[model samples]
Target: MINCDQTLSISNGKMKVAIEGCCHNQLEEIYKTLEHIENGENIKIDLLLICGDFETIRNTEDFNSMSVPAKYRTLGSFYKYYTGECKVPYPTLFVGGNHEVMSYLWELYYGGWVCENIYFLGYAGVVNFGGLRIGGLSGIYNDRHYDLGHHETLPYNTSTVRSAYHMRKYDAFKLAQIKQPLDIFLSHDWPRKITNFGKLDDLLHIKPYLRQDIESGKLGSAACEELLFKLKPRYWFAAHHHVKFPAIVYHDERTSSIYQSEEMNSKTIKNPDEINIDIDEDLENPDEINIDSTTSQPHISEDERRDQIPCTKFLALDKCLPGREFLQILDFPEANGQLEFSYDEEWLAITKATHEFLNLSFNAVSLPRESVIQSKIDPELRWIRENISQKAVGLVIPHNFQPTAPAYGEQQTFILQKPFKNPQTEAFTRLLNMSNKINPDGQSRPQE
Candidate 1:
């Protein structure tokens, strides 16, 4: 049995780690990487966030399908890869990929399935990394309405249904409703307009195919889009499209040129900056879109239980070889928030704190890599304007963490200019005061 607590633990002062998509049987890469890390550098990795697509099969029901061979063909293969090849170390966290979220939903709805050791964040949920709160929404499916048995008609497809069913709606809603703020957000799918590289399109063709699967649901989830626009986290990590390299998407701060021609206006895809705050894009009129989905039901061959639950089977692996783990270390005392790799407990604590703070500002900070932070004050001020002050952006930064100029190197401190007195500024002050008040103990508080 895998040890959930020590194996995949999250708390203050823990390591902040990252991993790309490991869909299906792509366990060899992780093994080789771990081996390389172990030999090349003595880094202790804390958290291994496999951003979606951990299952072997692209699309299939693991819940009620009787064909073990078919079922194992995908998830089974993935299972073997992890158990046999890469003994994943540290606490591995997973967000449901387009492939796995559906089956995961069935597993969650059905009672018998169990994923050992791994923390399966059901579509959306929040994880506490000590003082930091990392929230995520893994529900990204194209079909707005797919079939799931039981005869109870739902309004949206599995992903949308689960987005609301899981805690995403609440997370987005509460982020706006509350006076406090959340720290980090982990989403499998990037907000529709958040990336620069179309690289992932070829690398991870699954994401776009998944989008194609959703019947023109306006590109992406409006709820998720709304949260990104409104809450504006510190750092967000995602991997749906398997691009050779990761691209960062930052908020644009430039004034769009006025179009003189009407034809161009219609042809140009509206800049995401113009309409990110709108959540209405996600909700399809029930009349226009059929929510009474039966897609999964046809694939299911088992009889429904008295409780109306689908039957599921749990697989057990003997002496599972979890992935080799490493630690994410942040040198707070270094220039421009220098990030290095280390496993020391004391260093781990400081690194975790810095990571938590970074995650809190993921959406608001528009530079690549935390080390690029030149002026902490400037970023904090910019965050206030973009997120807190509601200022009109003049020069937008793309790829939240990626700096526009990589050669500039890391900045030590920032200069924040006092803005003209406005109602929003007052509101920001009120918010800061409120944060100080509730956090008398200095513990991070979730946005109500």
Candidate 2:
């Protein structure tokens, strides 16, 4: 059986680590890359973070169960790790992406061991690693099913398979409840319009083709944007689009006002005996509040204030491909084990009260669709619906524009490549070669 008792601790010094764009069943290549860095530079990676598309197919059964087209289905390297044919060389943590073995990941919905030394972060989760509080939300955003719960089950049919990738409202609600600061936040897709914050010219220069999507404001996830605005984590890492992009998000008074408003509103409940919620106070009203410069000023040094103001640094890397800027190493000070793994009390109370008021059970699987729709009119549920419904503002797309269609259809032709030349296979070959080179003694060394 895989070992799940690995201790997590980080010393006072800066933690050196490796980050990958997407692990599309390329675990071996990722290990080899880290191994190369470790052997060549004499540096140890404390952890490895994969943004998503971590296809952990264990065998033919898992391969058949995956939601990919029949022709695309093939068992990758995960089979070895699952069966103990090979073991992960280092501690690895990942979130689910669009293309994943959902059946396997769904079994560990609350986050648990995928195999020895590898972890799936669940639908949404916060885990402490050597004092650093790493929070992540798995799955991308799809507005059509944003409010829907995870009602899909195994042996997924065509519709359910697609639904598996969409982010659920419950997970998003739980994440918003986190009051503590997060050291890092990981997601599969970039927060919508995050590009507006920094170095846009550089990004556009590199990936000029994205100008249409960026300009049209159809690029990323709006739900992620709301969470970023609310939580303001130190560093946000994502992958889906497969490009190396970076941005600095400024924590303005607006974000602070929204948070403070929620905190204040939640406290205004005088008679705890009743579950009466004020819809007006609960919904975010950005224009109603004025920033009071005097009392609102944080008690911190100027440098610290500056650091906390334009605080969040957003980094997105390209997909795992050789000679690409898909891998990155960064340093972070030890969190000193100060991280706490708990839900925000207020959020939990609100979620609980709302459910109780609606006479809805946790997961509410048995509730009728009509009852679920009618429950939204309740004061507390209404507050949740209104508050989380903030869509991307000012992003206008041409009505004639079809995202899936080629812009210049007459001039463009698409070709499907053979399986041998597939990028995943290439990555596997690279990993195999690296492993062989590293194991000159012909003995496999467990990555730590």
Candidate 3:
């Protein structure tokens, strides 16, 4: 039932969007690529979407938190932007991958500004830009840590650091509650069996080792696959495989039905033995725990379905390197009024309704009971309408950025700074009238 198509939707003015793959901390090269695209194509890009591996390392201490080998680690261009030493040429938005500073990302679990003009999508979130509903889930999917909570904290050890970025079920389940349409959706990894819809022969030529996994029907994230079918976005982009591949997800008409209730998350864990596995250090190749991913299930109107295909165009790019297909430029419809970042109403409502379910301890987190959550959404939506949407500032994500860590290469002596509450996260949570779960005591660090 799967097929291929390019056209999605269209309008008057065009919004040229550039999509990049794994940054690998290559900000200078990425900027050059963006420059080249604009010069060659003779069109200005409105936004830049980075898929992951964006190492936002502020100091040497932050570098120690990455999962990569010591030899490959370096304070890349993010620090320059963080220190006001350089300026970003485009509005860059990104999700997190395994190679990121997990401690920094964890501080903004509900999504906040990592740097000026650069936005982190948190663990899982949605935002609107220039008439595009962009939703993404940070980190790659790992079976062992999928069912657990955010138990990892600062000063990570070898195991916890690596597991910190693994995608969690709680975030995935929250994303499933969305009911509106997404113009574009991003994930750090490709959806499972996605090769079935794309240029498989070319993929096999580059990644011959992946053949065994692909044939065994275990190549990508099942949660992503479920969301792809359910959200049915116009376009889906991903990175992390280090391959430039295109796949079109054709949604069945039946699958277009929205998941409005919470019963869809009740899946039986496959193995009880894995249940007793140590909570901090994960076991490799652990037994699978399924998330019956529910989706808001956007109903595309006849006019919205370009060429009447009813398919989500999916493209996954390679990492930033010479001769690699790491960048892509696509056209989206321009904004009707102004092009700026705004918070999605339904996403905020979901956050408000489910904030009580957030777990930050080593203990395994439980999903909010379906009955309890089902009843809370209505009241939360009403609260959002009265408190957020009707506010003087409205749903525009505020720009309250401030440096919390030392500049990347400052002359100051090496002083390790532990994580502090991000001002952006504090402001965001305060706007929602929710308590700041990240730094409950409102602790902060002296600006270096």
Better of 2 and 3 by TM-score: 3
* Ten contiguous residues minimizing lDDT sum, candidate 1: 259-268
- TM-score of each model, in listed order: 0.41, 0.63, 0.84
Query: What's the CA RMSD for each of the models?
Result: 23.9, 19.4, 12.2
- Candidate 3 lDDT score at position 46: 85
Between candidates 1 and 3, the TM-score winner: 3
- All models: lDDT? 0.33, 0.58, 0.74
Give a tens-digit lDDT track for model 2, residues 247-344. Answer: 55657764331222111111011111321223233223223333345797645633334434445767787776665556666556544442223222
lDDT of 1 by residue, 1-448 (tens): 1110111112233343534443343544454554454344454545555656555331222322221233445434344322223344544556655544232233322111122234544344554443444555664533232112122112234433333222233223323322234444655565553322223343235245644434444444566556665555544455554432222222233212210001100011111122111112221111222223566533321111111321111000111123211212221111222132111122112222222222111023222332332233344444444543353532121111111110111232322111112222222224333221111222121122
The backbone clash count of each candidate, in order, is 58, 2, 1
Candidate 2 structure, TM-score to reference: 0.63
| Model 1 TM | 0.41
